[model samples]
Target: MTQTLALVGAAGGAGTTRLAVEIGATLTRTGRDVAVVDAAYETQGLADYVDTIEADVTELVTDGAPLDSVVQPAALETPGQLSLCPARAPFERLARAKTAGAAETLEKQIAAIALSHDVVIVDTPPVATNQAVAAVDMADRIVAVTPDSERGADALARLSGRVRDVGESIDAVVANFADGTPQVADADTRVPATETTAPSQCPSCLDDETAFAPAVAAAVEAALDTTVELDFETSGRLDGLLR
Candidate 1:
């Protein structure tokens, strides 16, 4: 069976969506089919990674759209497929998608996509809505992504407590845009800041030169409990780099 992983943010603007796309790209490097599902309805950042989203996660859960039909392939040319189920809808539809009944539909849609993909990765926001709760509760493994700061560490603690309330615990933690986070020094993966790109372009992780790719590969490994053969210092600290 395909294992589901939820990469949830500890706070707002934690770079969760970018990290999710990089993780999916890294997994695809190993010939693994990945489905990048979006539960961050508020941000809809997953929409940036793809060219366009005709049918999306919001429609899947709210209007009962066919899950497979909505899963558009990410604009990547890797050996393995990187499909994205994004949320690019109006506020009214988004509101409806966040309802409890729609959350249940989201949970089922996740399982439905898992059948076709080797790994299902949900890009989740902070657990504030019913949809976020559904994603976290349905995931086989959860990885918390936080900024590398004192505030981020505090938020991570809160996220942990919230997960526990729902009978789940974070399997790992990733500190994005790390710049000497003494507060969260023990984060499972420390991702350095890299150059930003347009949402319509390919992910930077596809490049073999940058440290960003290998670091994200490390995060993917830790989050999914799999090995990624990349040449980067995942065990050391690379501070002062922009994410």
Candidate 2:
């Protein structure tokens, strides 16, 4: 069975894109057929991880093209392994499509992509929007990416409530930019915690080794085993939360 995971944030700038890239890359390295789709119409940063094709889910609703044609392979160091489908256009285009049923059409487009891959990692926009809600509603597992700060935790709490309203649950919470400091302990939430360190001074925000690669691998292993191991150097600090 194909497993689908949506990485969502309480609000923007919560590192959902980074987490999705790292996790997807890791899965690719482990010999899995991984497909990463950027569902967020506002930001397609996840496309930077690989050779990306600009696509709008709404196009599937109107054009009737098969989803496989719309997917673009990521241009990461690991080639021929990871695939990416980027959201280059706006969701407003989909909302405006004069299809018989817009929402159902959009859902079918997403389903087509999910059916083709062994693992589908979606980087969703904030939970406050209708598009994000649609992605989460269709996801089998949702990972809420938040920071280890009071405001970030509060945002997760609010998002958690919203997810519950739709009868969905957050499978985990990833703490981004978690320097190995006391601040890491601030995010006290129930979901399993995956802490990532701040990558060196680079344009893209993530550590080199532990950034996207390790996290993606860990998430994949965890999903298969029904438990994500949080023992890597960057993730080790979060062991307490896992226990």
Candidate 3:
């Protein structure tokens, strides 16, 4: 069966896009076809991961662009394909894409994408806009992505209410940018604060030695209910020393 999960941001810069991309990479390495669909129109941060974008998710949901055409596959050595359907649009189109009608179309568009892909991971903003609500509504599972801080936790608390308003609940929580085990309430895993690397070399979850690899793996297991091959032995400061 196909699985659809939304990684919703607890705050604006909660690293939701990064987490979604990393999750996609990890799933692809397991030989499962994965599509990281972007529903965060305003930020359009997912576009930063892909090399090029001839068309985007906005065009797909708003202008009726074909799914296969907008999907840009990443250059990964994994057995399964890792593709991104990101949104890169101006203010005008973005406004239209967030409309009630467009939000409904967005749900259908995501369902259509799920037909071909084994796993469809929606990169969503906080459940504020109509489109973001649609993303959550269409999702089979939902995970809140937040940074390892009090503000992130507070934002997460707010986000929980918003998600409940949309008739959904959070399946897991991932605390990003942590040196050790983060204390955020309900944080399933802690991803270290990794420095900026080339976009192509990113989703570093594929590398077992990376500090955040084990955390990413744990998130995958906890959120998606799957087993990860990577070991969670090296965590925190020692991870930096080994690498």
Q: RMSD, model 3, all Cα superposed?
A: 2.8
Q: Could you tell which candidate, 2 or 3, scores higher by TM-score? A: 3
lDDT of 2 by residue, 1-243 (tens): 878887887777776766665666666544556677766766656545444354544565556656766677655554225667665545666445433365456556667776667778777877665667777888888877777567677887888898998788877666554544423343422223344334222122123343443444444544333444333556564443332
lDDT of 1 by residue, 61-173 (tens): 88888876789987567878999988998999999999999999989889989989999999999888898899999999999999989988999999999989888899999
Give one clash count per candidate, in the order shown: 4, 7, 0
Worst 10 residues of 2 by lDDT: 197-206
Report the error of model 3 at residue 139, Å. Answer: 0.8
Clashing pairs in 1: 193-242, 193-243, 194-242, 194-243
| Residues 7-49, model 3: lDDT tens digits | 8999998988988998889888788999999999999988999
Give Cα distance to truth, residue 227, candidate 1, Å. Answer: 1.1
Residue 70 Cα positional deviation in candidate 1, in Å, after optimal superposition: 1.2
Could you estimate the TM-score for every candidate?
0.92, 0.73, 0.92
Ranking 2 against 3 by lDDT, winner: 3
* Candidate 2 local lDDT, residue 230: 37
User: What TM-score does model 2 achieve against the real structure?
Assistant: 0.73
Best by lDDT: 1
